[model samples]
Target: MTGLIETNETEAEAARKAEADAAARKRVADARKDADELAARIKVDGPRIVGELLSLARECAKQSLIAKALNAELPEGETPVPQADIVARDFGAEPRKDIRSRDVELWVVADDGRIVGDQAAVTSSDGITGHLHVAGAGLRWRCARRKFREVEFNPRTFTDWPGSFHELIRLPRLDGPGALFDGSLLTIEAAAALDVAASVKPTKRQPRPVQIELIPVDPTWPPATAAAPTEADANS
Candidate 1:
């Protein structure tokens, strides 16, 4: 009967609509899941982001006349000898060495509403979440100076994996007082934290795996210049 046929067609159309709705919901859920994994990866390797800031500062100092002037003013980390008004004899003397610093820290802020200090996660390990909450939180470093920089953690997190950056930066020094990608005499601790982050394998977790090796890039500066500034008088 015609009535029976109409009912069957209506049922078929309803089924198709249901399937399409389900697919759309699935896609949205998947996108949200991807965003979440990305956020976790960023949280783990955030330290390197701080290191990059330090590197940029070093590059700035290396290229600026102000830096050379400051270097001259500060001198090497060696002790300074007191210039005696009258010398007992015209003999030569060794200058005292200035104290050298191989340790420092800095700050890192995630942009684009990508990450927040919010959303604490409970790890599989017991109270591991609390440990992370304490250790992982805050700016990794407080400050950095000279071509010297330092990174926390016993082993290089980025080089080791499961802890590294998911973002690359081509940000200029103008972005912040200390924002560049190169520094002369950068310490290995910070180097591993920065460049190493973008080269490690993903943690590959369920639901969504953490993907790293994504970094901010500035191709303008050659690789050689990446570790330091380029100028006629780079040391200055």
Candidate 2:
């Protein structure tokens, strides 16, 4: 009876050890699968981050005009301020996708009571491109206090092409009211002649992502092909 009891005890111990080993192997396998899924997501959405950042920077630059248009309440002792035409820029796109979301303020102080017409200065990075002809979809005006009016279009539009040197330099497919010019329309012809988004360096804030991917356009693509339609003027 004593010998039998010893054998039973040894068997129980072996069974427990086997179970522990099996559980450890399963844990390793699960961890690897989780890592792979995360990696795949990063690979797919990482390129567009820079374009989003550029868009954010452009929107922040428009604060002065936006505040004036919205009739925003200044500080208690703030003087009555003049409003100027708000302008945003298309700087370039960057590669990193890990982005935080935040609000950017665009403000322009005008000596005059009303806004100045066509008061925008813009600059582009060698890696980014925005022409007067075709661009990404964005509103000419934004709802005050809700969100920024300027935007960076999705970089996935260019995924079907040759990638950029790295992530930060992708040329995004962008559209703004300024891109298309109908030479026939009087207003269109006048706008086409302007080069503000092309020339001025805008005030920019940090880049944020609404969706985790938070990527921007790839710089190397022919941006016009991926262009989508957007509102020309929000005030309209």
Candidate 3:
């Protein structure tokens, strides 16, 4: 009888332990899921918020300077008016011309972890994975995971492509120079290959998606023969 009682108690304890372990695992999984969701949100929204704030702050600073200058006399005849007055005088002197950019999308190919050229690539209509659409000023780039959070391109390192489609990009980081997001800028013609209907909206035309493939360079790759940099390199 005592043996039977002991066996029942042991089984109950084992069951309790199993339940505790399952609960612990569940909690850990939940935490990881939450963290991933937050990370995705940050990646998508972080850049846009930062850019808007920077722009807003700049506008505020200019307005404040102009307000202060308006109350002060313009310093006598070229004696160097306060910086504020100079800026304020120029603020609306000329008509503000809006700069329009044609939205272009392209796939940047990568070779051995570097962007080889600025020419964009034509993408097929299949599902896009391991690829992203990047768009920005002529050669400068701004890539977003979703919206607002833009990745800035550094011109110096990217111009070193030697025919292979590989180049390095500087992503935003709290620490200086985030890891290289390597890829190419598709040539202008690749814009025709974009999924236009998927990108358009009923109320507005969306910015074209330029898929950028971020691949880190392998420190282990063999070195190549030395050669002169091309025109693109010099221009970049």
Candidate 4:
């Protein structure tokens, strides 16, 4: 009777050990599957994730700069004043998709109440080709002509090729033009004319375009005076 009891106890111990081993093997296989799935996801989405993070950082830096400028211009004991009333509009399609094949018209205005006429500044979404035609009399037209001439008709200062990854165009500031023009209008024009092309080749997956907000900087905030350039000065 004692021998038989020992044999049964040993058999039971072996069964428990086998069950544990089988569970361990299953757990290992499941872990490996999960790891492989994660690796595949990262491989597919890594570039887009990195691009989004970079864009977020760029936007944050821009906001920080704007805040610093506002703080610096505020009076010592005065509350900060809002410069412009921002109006948000919702376009169903993404800006890149909407603006990609379209030409944009901008109404550039000056503080002196001068406006760019119907033959306004028109630019392609890509910023590669555009015409700056400001019709009307006075300092605004002259300033625009001079600036365009200086840049040889191309306002695009910097661009990342193979696609519109990033671009910078130098436009005359309100203060630079003797405060005759509104800085807000220039900002709007720049925002509208910005390039959004991601690639030259047609791909099913288009890269996300950079988003630009129309934030007007107050030309009067810092309080600097610039005399309007004379005809001779403009010509020279």
User: Local distance difference test, per candidate?
Assistant: 0.44, 0.42, 0.44, 0.43
lDDT of 3 by residue, 139-203 (tens): 43322121122334432322221231211212243222333122244321232232333322122
TM-score of 1: 0.28
Candidate 2 error regions (>4 Å): 62-236
| Cα misplacement distance, residue 40 of candidate 2 (Å) | 1.1
When sorted by TM-score, best at the front, the candidate numbers are 3, 4, 1, 2
* Superposition TM-score, candidate 2 onto the true structure: 0.28
Q: What is the TM-score of each candidate against the true structure?
A: 0.28, 0.28, 0.33, 0.31
Per-residue CA lDDT of model 4 for 91-135, tens digit only, reads: 222222221233343333323323346533543355333344444
> lDDT (0-100) at residue 193 of candidate 1?
46
Best-to-worst order by lDDT is 3, 1, 4, 2
- lDDT tens readout by residue for model 2, 1-236: 99999999999999999999999999999999999988775445533453344344333335444556556767787765532221222233445443345554332222222222322332224312211211365423211111234544444322122211121222332222232222223232233243434423233445775665656677665686876656865445
Best by TM-score: 3
Clash totals, every prediction: 18, 31, 22, 2
Error (Å) of candidate 1 at residue 42 is 2.0
Error of 1 at 21 (Å): 1.5
Q: What lDDT does model 1 reach?
A: 0.44
